[model samples]
Each structure stands twice: as structure tokens, then as C-alpha cells.
Target: MSIENPQPLSINSMAALVTLGKFLEEDQWFPQLLENKRIYRVTYSGKNGQFVCFAQIMNKTSIIMCMEETYESKVQW
Candidate 1:
């Protein structure tokens, strides 16, 4: 779950990125385009709960990630 980029990321952020990459690579996620930006969506059910994630790679520099747990959890972006 480690990113080989210069940007710093927290442990949880790294894990999320790894999950996003895996889903994308496996062609298991949906991609949307908005204002010429490509956003990826990953949705699945985990042991803890149902999870949905949105990730947008911005300017090839940083990632904007959002996740919502469908188990009485607040959304994080």
C-alpha cells in the first residue's frame, strides 16, 4: 500500500490508493469524465461494511479521494 511518488501520504490514504489501483487494473471499477477530468469509482462490500470510493487523479500530481461507508459512517474526501 505504498506509493512510489514524491508526495507524502498517510497510511490509510496509501491503502485507499492501493485499493483504487487494484480495482482499476482489474477493470472492476467504473470511470467517469467530468470537465475533462477522469474520475474512477470503486464500489464493493467489505467485511466491515459496504464501501464506495471516488478517486480523481489531478494534473498527474495529486489524487483527490472520497469514500463513503454505508454503515452509519460519515463520508470522507
Candidate 2:
């Protein structure tokens, strides 16, 4: 059956949205993936470990860089 209305976001989903909004606004992390790729994938490392995120080529213009990550050890890139 087709539904006319959609369900509201769960509490966890809402929290994720807010967290992602803050992350995108304040985090300046991006990966230098394969050459000529339209999308870039990056991993963010924190005290809790690493998580993955990505951005599209067209979205680069609107992305804001609030901070850059510093590693205690040397990284490949």
C-alpha cells in the first residue's frame, strides 16, 4: 500500500542530524581519495576511534573549514 504521510524522525535520528550539522559546520575534514573521483571520502579519528564521512565535488564550494585535525603520529596523507 502507498503511504501519504511519512513518520517523524526518531530521537536517535534527530540527534544524529544535529550532530552532523555541527560536524559539517565546524569540522574541516576531507579525504583525498582516488584521483578524478567526483566524491571524496575521509575518516575522522578521535579519542573514541575513527568514523567515515564524505563530500561531493559540487558541495565543495559550500563546505566551511572550521578546523583541521592534528595527529600525534605521522600519517600517510
Candidate 3:
């Protein structure tokens, strides 16, 4: 759904558009987002409790808003 029709999503729409992996071009935005206070390091809870990742935070929101997750993350490229 996300690839075919990328648009604003809502519960009333019956589903949401989500991406599995982002493109390399998108990584360019991360640094600026960090400087703008829109993204930061997060524990990114996992089975082993030994992971760290970055999350884009919504304006005037709490970090706890993110759900518990386990991602096969890559820290250094």
C-alpha cells in the first residue's frame, strides 16, 4: 500500500502506509533532523537489551510514544 499509494494515513482508512527499509538517499536527512532536535538516540528495546537506535520524535511529544521493538539494526556503515 505504501509503495502504490503513499499518502497521509489514518485508522479510518483501514490501514496505514509503512516502509520496511528506506533508501540510501533518505539517510541524508538524518543529520539535519538530529541537529533540529527531531531525532535522537533511543534504547530500541530488544530481546537482549543491547541495542541502540535513533528515532524521529514528533514536535512537543514524549519519547515514550514509540512502541517497544527489536530491529536488526546497522550502527556503522
User: Which candidate number maximizes lDDT?
Assistant: 1
Candidate 2: worst 10 consecutive residues by lDDT? Answer: 57-66
Give the poorly placed runs of model 2, Cα more than 4 Å off. 1-30, 59-77
> For residues 25-58, what per-residue lDDT tens digits would candidate 3 score against the true structure?
2553222224433344444333445545555433
Q: lDDT of model 2 at residue 16?
A: 52
Lowest summed lDDT over 10 consecutive residues: which window, candidate 1?
1-10
lDDT of 2 by residue, 1-77 (tens): 11233344456654554555456556665444434333345667766456565543222132323245546674443
What's each prediction's clash count?
0, 0, 0
lDDT of 2: 0.47
Candidate number with greatest TM-score: 1
Task: List where candidate 3 sits over 4 angstroms from the true fold.
Answer: 1-33, 44-49, 58-77
Superposed by TM-score, candidate 3 places the C-alpha of residue 32 at a distance from the truth, in angstroms, of 14
Task: Output the lDDT of residue 36, model 3.
Answer: 37
lDDT of 3: 0.35
> Which scores greater on TM-score, model 1 or model 2?
1
TM-score head-to-head 2 vs 3, winner:
2
Query: What TM-score does candidate 1 reach?
Result: 0.42
lDDT (C-alpha, whole model) for all candidates: 0.55, 0.47, 0.35
